[model samples]
Target: MSVESSAHTAAPRRVVIENCAIATVDARDTEYTSGHLVVAGNRIESLGSGPAPAGLEHVARRIDGTGHLVTPGLVNTHHHFYQWITRGLAQDRNLFDWLVTLYPLWAGIDDEMCYAAAQGSAAALLRSGCTTSTDHAYVFPKGGGDILGAEIRALAELGMRFQPTRGSMDLGESHGGLPPDTCVEDTDAALAATAEAIDRWHDPSFDSMLRVTAAPCSPFSVTRELLRGAAELARAKGVRLHTHGAETVEEEAFCREKFGMGPTDYLESVGWLGEDVWMAHCVHLNDSDITKFAATGTGVAHCPSSNARVAAGIARVPDLLAAGVPVGLGVDGAASNESGELGAELRNALLIARLRGGPAALTVRQSLRLGTMGGAKVLGREHEIGSLEPGKLADLAMWRLDGVSHAGLADPVAALVLGAAAPLTLLLVNGREVVEQGALSRVDEEEIARNVTRAVTRLHGG
Candidate 1:
């Protein structure tokens, strides 16, 4: 069980993983047992379960994964990385009320809090076998913190792909938005800062690990002009756009009460319906709305735990997939979920889908696909990473099924989802091991924990 460090250590540029069950979540979620994956550089050079490839037998070093599950690294499509510091607050409230209650506390956040929370959230996600993930950090307190830059730095230091959006709030409580006046930004400043983030961090390359996005918070927090301006600016800067939409019934009621339309129509009016745009928590779209998203190439980030925790109805995820809408899984913000584990949410996705659409609705393959492939599509990084196919970035995880949770399991993929364990054995981002043998190999855990403690204490007025 001696895993060679990388690229054969010295002789060759390859990693040969043999005798494992590789679950390739391609167009079809296929499994091949007793297989081998030849990793050269940052791509899977070859993979199959038959006789070894011609050159594999001559590789420098090899480790056998006799009873392990080697799958594409999990992708988290949506999150508020900063909310790791704000966990366990304003619970039991609906979406709008919850935002109102937490806005003041979030306004108190500074750069240190943002960095600690970002690092902590990304670390937890990586621990949960996730490689590439997205962060929708939208609470930019005026004159308080460098939240976006800090998030980028945290992700860079941890060696994970980060889609840190420059989320802004131009409309406040005084102007009928969720945030307070102290937290909201002027329209000019918001747009300017978004452009600057794009210039500084937005990398559109195939192997990029850091990307910038423009997110104007949500419907109730941003004006119509800001939404259109965000889209225009993002397109001009060649980046993507993201925001919250149709998350709860309260949001629907607010749209009807305030704008006299549904959330889907609200998106259309604000020029936010198209490719390169994905909205989070679309739990309340109708048939026509679903068709609109399908036709327009819009993506949805389905948050099962957060929805059920807040008593929001389950998203029509099966229906959305059937209707051709690109839907992915998200753990949502920690303040709502309290735990940022994509594996747990994948289990919840299956359980909740079964509760709604009966058994055999959301299959185990579909759940993993949503987390791996569907998530890559949602975050607009499908070509770069997601599956264990060749030419994709070397982002993956190995779940050692010899543990207690997966005891007596025959099928490795099934054991992986049902096992309910986070922080996988080996996690890699761009061919770099961030979590090796169930511990973080990327950043400092004790330092991050100390920073998070200080941030949380400061948040509690200590």
Candidate 2:
């Protein structure tokens, strides 16, 4: 596969993907075994079974979709891109102890390391069929040299859609938080920087490539003042609010002892339990907590692999979906999950839900929905990018089912969820091909891997 930057030129005025199995994932869950999807500019013009639309016959490019399965591009709701360099450290530690072990090492991060890590992680995600991802980078070393900007730059260079959260941690170990003082920032400085980032990078328009969110690190690692201030700032800026909530039992206990309530209640008290807020993990919610999330339209990013790796209890996904909570998929951090692959995360979500409940816990279609439409809803972009509809963005993933892994499957869609992982044959963001033939189009994966290795070695004192 050739690697070339696709962002410089506009996509072909029209593109027609013909003779593929299309999973529309629309409101009615429409699907077709042999169909065509027509794209005019950045939006999908039309898609249906049978021959190509009348005027699309003369499109500049017509990709032959034989032996391919087409679906809406996957969306990742939560991630920590910097953690890509710390994947194997703190092998056996749980949430709190894991942070204790890695906080010191994270303090050594610089702008170069941030760029390398984001490139490596985003490249892996793009190869695995994730076109849009939200990276919650909460560690702001006092003089880390614009780590957030470096990450955004890398994402742009890789040609992936991003929502990079301006995450902060103002309470340190000196103030009963888990992170060290070196990694925490002054409250006012953090808020001001966050606002500056939104002003500089946020694009609220349709089919935007980059958006910014304001995120406080976590309940135990940040102060109440920072939480309230971030929520107010995000709302005023017209962006969303994101944070870590109900991820572990220790976090829930800390919320109870410090705030005289559970995690959900504390979130509500901080003015963060609303439609514009989406939380990560959420493995420890109770019945009332689920009710509050559903009623308030708050979203949840379910990191099944990370929760299982850290031994955090499984989230009640069945119950959450049953209660009308908008639930999406996330790989969390590479340090926690050891990989940032959304395809594998979708399979893990299905297997873990069945493990928690019975055989009828979750369906393959439901798991796919969580990775696509559910993630768009969680990030408040459902109107533009979730489904493969006439007016939606032409972001898509094409998987080749002719490989050995899916040779004998009767249903390609079910085989995608049940079979072993397969690399995406093609991926597009806003009608531009960022990944083609299972490789990144704009960046060299070998160079990214080498740079990330050097950064990790430097951080590890090698």
Candidate 3:
């Protein structure tokens, strides 16, 4: 929908939250032990130390944020919303093996399944303090019936700021690709459909709640022609490009054997490396590959738990950061990372980085940045939704740190990142309340659960 069509006609709505610890996650990493934030309409009006300035009028809401920590709402840079219903299906497999096991079931998915899955995924993300999320949905069953639109409706109903890619796979098992023939699309058909989705759904306005991306699934599942074509189409349409790359050893081997080069090199050959592109996983990138990624301004969507779940080696996150590559945290697919908690990913990324590069590999604030500002940079929305600054979108999370799990922490940021997943006192997306008092405000959780149960049963042929 166009921004004008969906614009609110009501008078300006303002909310004030005080007595909270604010971590801006800006370039300077500004922090205030006791701060006040003002949200006017859909943007942050002002935020700084101490109470809000007096004489504020027409206040819509005033929150006593005692013992709470406020930060930018987490941004999930990569996900497969369609995989929510299929969680735990391939529990004991590597990346390739897991896809092989799940392909046939995925090939049978239709619009109904995708809507339920998208709802479930959005619910999990919001409960975990995620406001904006990008979905990489590549499996397009021929008779699925507008799967992308189904997911778009589901997320919009839940008030999620969404950037969903019209992902496609042109190379199938018949062509030595990973996905089955039924799950892949014709190269030209996929490109045309992607352009159609972009024209119909993409809104380039600054406060747009929905944007479209063009993504060809992966090296092993998409032909070189499709990759180059997708990149060209994305640039022409002013949308970003996303895909899976360097995710596992098997994928690296596949690229080397088939394309006579590494995954990074193959991507560069197809014009896939650029500021407009962000690749997921990237766990197997070598030093030279990291150099190219930095030089080309490419981004990485780091998925620590998913990599660990599939036994994919730890990505060199510290080295990647040192090389000036934009790295963001991702929950990945629920089928692989069943928790689907973007909040927990902050800690997971920290622990994994330390495991790979020692105690000081990643700081608590750095991990938080990965989920907030870094993610915004990767998705090219840094100026819009990454920090708690005036003129930016009021997409922020208020974590209740006074509870048993986080009280007396002294450092709110550390409590949020190193401690247990804190419950959100409130979650705001575009100055609108999505999660209030730790529950979704717009949709019933019980209803979402029931829908997911039904969808899963249907997918299982029950």
Candidate 4:
């Protein structure tokens, strides 16, 4: 089954998907072989087996899902969309060295570069079955004007559900931080800009296309004062908080030497270890830290590919899950992971979990949950867009099982995670199709690639 076109229209506000295998990642983890789902006005109206609803039969748009596998659209809990411009550069470096090498180039980013990079990255994610993502754009060059705003505009054009974090790094080398002075910002200016972004873009309603989070880049690059202030401001404004935590042993040593405690302790001292916060790359944490996270409802975004690429240690995903901590998958940054494909991230997650524990450490269903429902839980969006229920948003991905990769797979749903990554036949967010026939419908892929290449050339001075 394939969608005819990717044209954006509201004429057919209702759609019925008939005769597909549905993996509903709901509370019960339900699965149906010959299921039917109805989408009406940006929300799922109903779903079951045998027949469509009475009124949905007359809907204009009907997608024949004879040989397709449908599931909730995957959610990416953490990313740096602008890093798509720097893929394959600094390939052999560790975390600290990679950041130092790329900071200067990132300082050269302008409004156009941000737009192109965000568009390209979002396009890649859509093709890989991600309908919702959180972009951590923390670099604020000295003279760059509203780079976050440009990123938001570009993502909107792609029709993706975006959470653009107002990320900051106010501690520079002059202040004993990793980033240079030109790459950091004044604390007052950063706070004000964050508030402005929240006021201008954040919509806390159901099925909102855009939301904002306050993220101070990381422990070594930001000040303790900024962390405390950002958390207070986010809570006062009713937004979420995010940052990098416990990613490396070197980072743990730095936190201990600088703050007189471990990463998790420092986070608590700054009043950031709470339910409204989610941290990226928690690859190193003590047993106590895991207990604290489970107790406080803190979330972790696991970036398996980036961790392996940088020689960072494997994260304790099975332990975290057993402890009842909310854990989600993340494609940290295109430069580090070298791929913004969320489906590939899902596969890496399964392999890495089994590598650390045993073959039974992570199942295909569990990994799929981490990419979908677990991600929604991380972002506090489980109520709206995680599963395919009657009241949930119409965000879904359809993969055709007719391809060679899945030719003889007996279980199509399991093949999606255990088999090779496959292109999405159709991707819908808020009842609007963004990808159709294995291509982005709203944006021209070739044009986005060309613009991103031009931006990278300009930044590299070639």
Candidate 5:
């Protein structure tokens, strides 16, 4: 499938996916059997099964999505875009061994590599039906590099909504942290960069293009003081705080050994339990921790593919969702999952939940919901971009399902999860098409693969 087709119409025009079976996921009449989705000026004007509103005749361009799965653009709550260059190298290793083997390679990253990796990952994600992504780029590697700016620029070119965390790895092995000293940072520099990112990018408005969350890498990679300070700094700036917590049994052991407490206990002591916080992985949480997270409105980014890849236990996603935990989907990192596709995460999430909680435990709708609305809840952007209502941003994905795998399916929604990735025909972010016909609309994706290939060769001595 080539993406160089006519894009349904000419550019600099009002685009509409007309006669599509619109699935708004809104409160009333959410599913439109066959209707028009008018994207006049970056927002859905009116979507329903019946005729359009009074004067919708002025749509300049229209693409028909009659046999497609249309929904709110999927949100990626967690990711390390830079890791796309280093995937599959440290295979069969647990978290500690995994980090140990990869840290050296990661220490060599510059802004160019970060930009290329983020562009590649963002293209892959959009091709898999994701429209918005939040990247956790915590590894600065003590260089004169601008990784965040590179990634932000790439995403801006792609027209994806970006929420990057000013992540820091302050505590080195000398300080009982996981990263080496080269990858660690001084406390003052870390805090300064955090403030700089927030001041430059953090947008509190509803139609924000990019936002910065102060992220200390994890419990094992940061100090208690750094964690508390990051939280305070985030609160002062009104941004979010993110980190890793209880991702594996080994992490649990590390926390108990280092802090004399579990991961949740250490986080709670550091005032990390709050509505403005969300953690990645979260595979080894206890019952009490679940309760605390739910009560405090803390969110979790559930990464089934990454957990299973490193042999981390399958997170009790069922229990977490049942316990009122705001659970969202994450690919974690390409190094762990080897696949950064957000729709791939949906498939893994659905299957893994069913494996643990039986067939009725997770449905296709629920899985897709997790990637969209659930992710928005985790990011506190639910009211803005999760659904396909009129007021929401026109961030959406259209997966064509006319293939044999989905041809005979009675319901499009059911076919979406079970179908063979459904073949993304178009992905829109803020009414702009970033991907068309399963390829990036802007940068050369094949060139990205070639660059990453060369980068990997340099990374591990070819």
Candidate 6:
């Protein structure tokens, strides 16, 4: 396949990495104790055991991957990138109380603030071995000034594959929603903006670096009309749908009181459950809800740390997996998950599943899969970006396992998911290095940190 070049003059370059432990995360759970992977342009040319074949032609860069474990880069299924600058607020509050406190604060956001926050969020994700991420950006202030555009620009600059939803919340506090009036939009206007975003940014190519989704914020924060409209818009435009659902018991109660149904049922009523739809949380899903999700091919973005931080109950992840519902890990937003590292969610998902369903609930490899293949499935990119197979997008993480954090584990996957977040040796998105030596390669970390500080100061009126 031909790759796009910046100057539109040269063909794509090829790179090789040898002497690493490769965990393909493929259908058969393939692994190589020592192997070599060749990347030609934005696709994996080939990968197999032992040294690379002699006289590999036209090599541009070669990396010695000793003491590293290479896996398909972790994919983040849900996040609020704008939440990076607004972390630490509403710490002691549940979902409802937290939104009540932060809605006004978030309402002041603009393009400048979103660009800075998105960079900070992407920086954290890149360093933590995440190469692909889907952001649910719903809080569009009236004069937000290209909020979605800002996010798209920031991630594009950083060279990470992005799927950002044009999310909307039309139900304000007056309408029994959690958000303040200023943070919500009109139903028709929201739908129009969502469609506009897709036209402007969504790329559906096999090696697509950016795609757009239509997201109505959540069951409690959106009107039933907005939910139905968003689903229709996304399907008509051939884009996926995303939203928050079943996040907490309070949300369940809100749905029951207002819509006379549970969150899942309300979603299904509005045509929001399908292969193209993936909901965040699903923390309060019942057995029937799980069955519905599986039967309809609805996916879930399991945000374990954020759920725990907000006192949301443990999600029935093991049960969902058993019922054949696709499950993926999410760092959520930085406000609820301050670390904002997708790599850590691998460990958190494992522990949370085991906490709810005992020791055998989720294995280390399963945890890694949740962050990789499962996430790819949720976002409808499974065939293109999930695994490290030939012809797949060359998006993968080279994790360093020789450090103090993970030196002695026999199984590299064990040290990765069961232990603390393993530091990345490199992170590749579309065969381009977004991160190297655990730092962003395309931008300066210090510059990103400074921008975040400025954005925070502006947001807080400091």
lDDT of 4 by residue, 253-273 (tens): 889999999999999999989
Candidate with more favorable, higher TM-score: 1 or 6: 6
RMSD of each: 1.9, 2.6, 3.8, 2.0, 2.8, 3.2
Instruction: Return the lDDT, model 6, position 92.
Output: 98
Q: What's the ranking of the predictions by lDDT, best on top?
A: 3, 6, 4, 2, 5, 1
Q: Each model's TM-score?
A: 0.96, 0.97, 0.97, 0.97, 0.94, 0.97
Candidate 4 has an lDDT of: 0.90
- Check candidate 6 and list the clashing pairs: none
lDDT of 3 at 462: 99
- Show model 5 residue runs off by greater than 4 Å: 1-13, 27-29, 458-462
Q: Is candidate 1 or candidate 3 better by lDDT?
A: 3
Q: Compared with the true structure, what per-residue lDDT tens digits does model 6 show for residues 86-111?
A: 99999999998998888899999999
* Superior candidate under lDDT, 1 versus 4: 4
lDDT score of model 3?
0.93
lDDT of 2 by residue, 318-382 (tens): 99999999999998899998878988988899999999898899999999999999999999999
Pairs that collide, model 3: none
lDDT per model vs. reference: 0.83, 0.90, 0.93, 0.90, 0.84, 0.92
Best by lDDT: 3
- The superposed Cα distance between candidate 4 and the true structure at residue 20, in angstroms, equals 0.7
Question: lDDT score, residue 173, model 5?
Answer: 92
- What is the number of backbone collisions in each predicted candidate, taken in the order shown? 1, 1, 0, 0, 0, 0
lDDT of 3 by residue, 1-462 (tens): 001122334556778899889999988999999999999899999999999999876577888898899999999999999999999888999999999999999998999999999999999999999999999999888788999999999999999999999999999999999899999999999999999999999998999999999999999999999999999999998899999999999998999999999899999999999999999999999899999999999999999999999999999999999999999999999999998999999999999899979999999999999999999999999999988999999999999999999888989999999999899889999999999888999999999999999999999999
Worst lDDT 10-window in candidate 4: 2-11
